[model samples]
Target chain A: MTPDPAAASAPGVLVTGAAEEEVLAAVVVALRRLCAGGAELHLRAPPVLDASVADRAGYSTSFPHLLGAVSRGGAATDLVLTPAACYHVYPLFEGRVLAAPAEVSVLADCHRQEATTERGRLRSFRMFETVRLGGAEDCLAWRDDRLDRLGHWMEALGLPAERRPANDPFWGRPGRLLASAQRADRLKWELSADVADGVRQAVVSVNHHKEHFGAAFGIRTADGEPAHTACLGVGLERLLLALHHAHGPTQERWPTHVRDALGLTRSCTN
Target chain B: MTPDPAAASAPGVLVTGAAEEEVLAAVVVALRRLCAGGAELHLRAPPVLDASVADRAGYSTSFPHLLGAVSRGGAATDLVLTPAACYHVYPLFEGRVLAAPAEVSVLADCHRQEATTERGRLRSFRMFETVRLGGAEDCLAWRDDRLDRLGHWMEALGLPAERRPANDPFWGRPGRLLASAQRADRLKWELSADVADGVRQAVVSVNHHKEHFGAAFGIRTADGEPAHTACLGVGLERLLLALHHAHGPTQERWPTHVRDALGLTRSCTN
Candidate 1:
């Protein structure tokens, strides 16, 4: 019997076997190269973040529907499962003034309470993120550059993906305005690919936070202005799912170019 | 200013730099070699576990004080941040009968709500676990064999540690009996090392569960008997903390043998 991808390991949990792990490693290497230079890789981040930090990030208020809290005996604790990887990076520079642009690469096991159990909508997932922080122009420029590169990376991997304007699923009516404003400001863009039969999902998200976190955390730019931030996150599991959907669940048969792009050498069985 | 390891990245989060990452990779390689053959490596698992799984594992009943629940708002969700890596392994074999012994190596970001926050007692930590499930004789034999090998591995790494009888922090009065019984039966052993000044913490835990998980999850051996289970877990960050305490904080200044054992070549700098 085949293992249910979501429940194979645990609910909303996707466990990677040898072949999948190889592909993920290759993908990460490719991503780091694509990021070029000056990116510091923070190999691990806590799966949980402080509740106050989450509140300051406006996550609890902006997307309460997707939030998950850590508790003891059904009573709320001061911690929450990290909703995003970049959340860990921002707090590291709290109340600090950056002399130059900072780019940090982080990988975190992120959690979200999903209402759906679709192929790509996992409750728990791995987020491969790169966060850039500095002046507004630098952050926005980096976001734009990485967005295009990520779109091209997907194409190079033989994934039929599109880069499109997007918005977070903010909750309620006020959220609707926020979503509208986000789109109007071009604050978010996603690289989406089909992970099921005609069911497309966003595998890569490029977000620009215009002083939202900087103002909240008191991170200032060289000129004493609130530092702007941008992040690019790749949902590793969803990307694997997309690859499986596109290439018959087997990596050997994938196009040669795609394999080379991902550094999946012929000898790399595992 | 040095960042507080606990709060550097986030509360209970330990972020690894380039050098630390190198050491960890080397350590994993050595552990895998020590495990020998017939081991399947599961590279990733969900940070959260289903509440039912936790209940069946007796984790909540035994260690209620250390349990962390995943909730939405203040209400409990069906999920809990995984307390251990082996919890993810059992569900995979649910209702299955194994023809041969199974050995699975898994790495998961585990969480615990400890009453204290010290260098080794992290709220969130990485657990590198290998679970063996089969006949009682095979399980216990494998547990004992691996326990000694792990102890030797720590010694080879130049960490002064001790392997001693240990018991889970079972809850309440009835739990005391369970702890005493466990100790009397020699069911649990830990490799404890000094993580701080006079603070010795358990960096590795080896436990044998005689038919506990197998019966709960309906797993059976070839003879149709409940499969026995045993697990060996290395608290990766704690080991790192221990290494820092034993050797100097700088990997370059560590004993040549220790650095060589960890594959931290002098030329290998972050």
Candidate 2:
């Protein structure tokens, strides 16, 4: 990713004010427009999920370092903070056989405990994702299509983001081999952008999960085969910071097309 | 709170689907219109909050039973899932003097470890709140005004909810004293509605905090007096359940005005 000096001073995480809300609203609208294929949209989902569901999703085994467990009054509970928005989607389709491909779009506040407090690497952040479930070839093709569409969307917003092959930050010794295999198969591709001064980060990730979640959740296709899944996930806060970097901190001064794309027109009246 | 037989079988905690998304979006639009007064709107807030902030807010002492603590890999962390939406707003104004009263509205997913698994008393739920910070008199009057307006809104939606004096389920002996004091001061009023079969719940809470949060967060008015705070909070899923009870389960068969109010017209296209 190309370095941009303007994003060097971009505010990391926006937790207050109307501008942040406006930007998020705009992002939702844009995502809906981009994923307009009879998609089921969910505006909110619980931050915590059932531990059994997490275990079935292989979250702890794959990335144990990132899991956040929830307890009541210092006593352990059967819940963990959601690591990804798509995890919630998989449970909804569990034990069902899809007649055709299923499309789901959700915006959820996801949590992961990161070892580093670096910019754009927030422990708590919002994720806007469009998930597709179908055959393996269909899922991979959908992932590629989303990558191109998301890349164009970034360009439209005046941000220079590069799409590159990537892998999950898996845990333990076995995780190293898993990460290498994932890269060899090119299961993940990230749209990297300069969110801060010389700080390049992945703002969007498109991943293809080949029969992993479906096999775990007992979801199947009409052909008696485990369904494949793919997700195009956008990190909302990181995207906002990238916008701030490319368009400057002030919304009023940003290009008209960019503002229109993000629906950032300042309303005089509430 | 009047009983409604239709709501007896209403589903609780809708985590997925297009209808759930539509209802939430409608609730947000209605809230924005109701809270139209140059309010700062936040669509999201982290489910977990800093332990120190929760302590300063007196949440642990007041409602210890409802708090959910966060841990990473069995090790405790200094974080707790937010119990209410208003707690996040107070810390934003810490040690600051407001020139005028500040109005903020937020929609956040709140977690409260309720002892019961009854309908409408969810462990995890969405809260849409409009908060006000100003002088004591202003806060009290705002609370009353909100109570009246929200009552009308409920009536317009064809729901038979009663506005009654209430108190938080404070914990222990000291909490008992605080609850009694709050009740004596008439600081809290709830719009109680029958969300299910014989399940009377507080669908909305209008609270007047006379310098409590202000003192805790060190927020002051221009005249140097600690600011008073008030919040009008609506439980989204409970309200939806109440609506279902009042109008039946089928959205297509509901009254046109009610459908219009909720923006629940089933779109033919995505």
Candidate 3:
């Protein structure tokens, strides 16, 4: 079945790499393709060492300055990539994009057994709920960073963009704490008609969380405050599934769009 | 750090595929490798008809027939592989061991977004809970059909092999349900010690889902229960951070295990 045109055009792909190697491989391939096509790439790297390192080295430093070294190059960079053990940390690298070699690759390896457990799931669920409700602004702040980045990319490309606060219904409504809590974090963007093409062609990366199941895109209707936005996820396997769905398995016969996105040239045999 | 020798010897790997093509690609490659070594393979495939067709053919009729086809291959087949989506309909496929094509692979394309999501970190947690509740036994039973086939291969090869219930604590406990009630509609698997080595050596066919977060595997303890498992997930961009962590991006070398697993045989030329 055809996906909703809106979703198809504004597709959001979700990719998972089984291991660190696979994740990097997919990202590296994507970066190479994007950069090679002259698409501006953004890189964000949050320092692993804390300010204590500066004290040890006899260097007094501000967090911004320390982070600046990591975030420099902004739009000049071809990819914005960072390591975040926790999702909350992702926003710290916001506003700063770095430049690196097209071939440069990062590897984040985590063991599932190590990271997840029944207890862990429960803790995460609790933490997620708590932070989401108690720290609504913080959550909005994280989301803002991403939305702002999209704005930045648009500006860099000289595309017309517009930012408008959505008239979200749940923004100030009271009843359920979760409902009131959700309003604490909300942001929306509407690109100018001129950049509609760019927005249509653009792909937004969404980091998955359980909360995402409820609100994947964070978009809400003017009156339908809780009406979550539609997100287009690219299931690593499902993408292949889509490929098979649209085209056959043979790489030679893959859709031109997919091939181009993946930077896969037709093999002579194909 | 070196993984535990016992763990390494009995390493468990989970490979997710996107579509049947990608799944087949990964399986074929893995099978070729194992076939050359004359190794035995076990597999399990749950019955999953196309959604459109599922309604017409009740699951009872569909599942057994599918299982029968897989069992018909008997001991000659060295590896086992199956569609993960089947698990959604047939939760019983979890604990059972099956004779696969000498290699096992699952399509992980659907999990790309899930892997990278905040919830992705909870994969192990999900596995632990799923197994602990004995919810995976039915899935295991489904898988056992194929394991029985593999047993035939072992018997024919004069290889000492036996199938016994795993005693992993994670798979033995019963617990209150967590996550959304809808999760009950999805399929689940528990790891078994007997299946760990095959999983590790097996090449997982990933799409974007599994690639986004990391790779996940199921593990079984001595009591035939799925205890602890691991998912080697690295955010695509996080890898670069990790590289910086281990050694500066320039003139760097990853840990031996990391390098070996990724098949990164060469130094960074760029």
* Worst ten in a row by lDDT for model 2 chain A: A1-10
- Residue B125 of model 2: what lDDT? 83
lDDT string, candidate 1, A1-270, tens digits: 323323555557676666787798778777877863567455567788888889989999999989999999878988888899888777788898988888888777888889888778888888889989889889999999999898888888888678889999999999999999999999999999999997899999999999999999999998899999999999998999999998877888988888888877634111
lDDT of 2 by residue, A1-270 (tens): 111212211122235455666777778877878864657444456677777778989998898899988888778787788789877778778787988888888777888888776778888788988889899988998899989988998998999799899999999999999999999999999999998898888999999989999999888999989999999899988998898888897787889989877766634221
User: Residue A245 lDDT in model 3?
Assistant: 34
Interface RMSD of each: 5.0, 9.3, 21.5
lDDT of each: 0.84, 0.79, 0.24
Q: Write the per-residue lDDT of candidate 3 for residues B137-174, one digit (tens) a residue.
A: 43334344334443443233222343432211111113
**Candidate 3 C-alpha lDDT tens digits along A1-270:** 111211210011111112322322343345333322321212211212122322222222211111111111111111111112122121222222222111111111111101222211110000000012112233344444445554554344233345543321221223244333433333333333221222221122222122331232232223333222111111122223323333453655645554544445423110
Model 3: docking quality category: incorrect
Better model by lDDT: candidate 1 vs candidate 3: 1
Alpha-carbon deviation at B239 in model 1, angstroms: 1.1
- State the lDDT at B195 in candidate 2: 80
Error of 3 at A75 (Å): 45
On residues B1-270, what C-alpha lDDT tens digit does candidate 1 reach at each position? 323333555445677765676677777766767863567555556688888899998999998899999899788888888899888888888998988888888777888899887667788888888899899999999999998888888898887678899999899999999999999999999999998899999998999999999999999998999999999999988998899999878988988889777666634111
Off by over 4 Å in 2: A1-14, A36-43, A263-270, B1-13, B36-43, B250-253, B259-270
Which model, 1 or 3, shows the larger DockQ?
1
Write one digit per residue (lDDT tens) for candidate 2, span B88-205.
7777777889888888887778888787777788877889888899998888888898899889888888887888889999999988898899999899999988888898899989
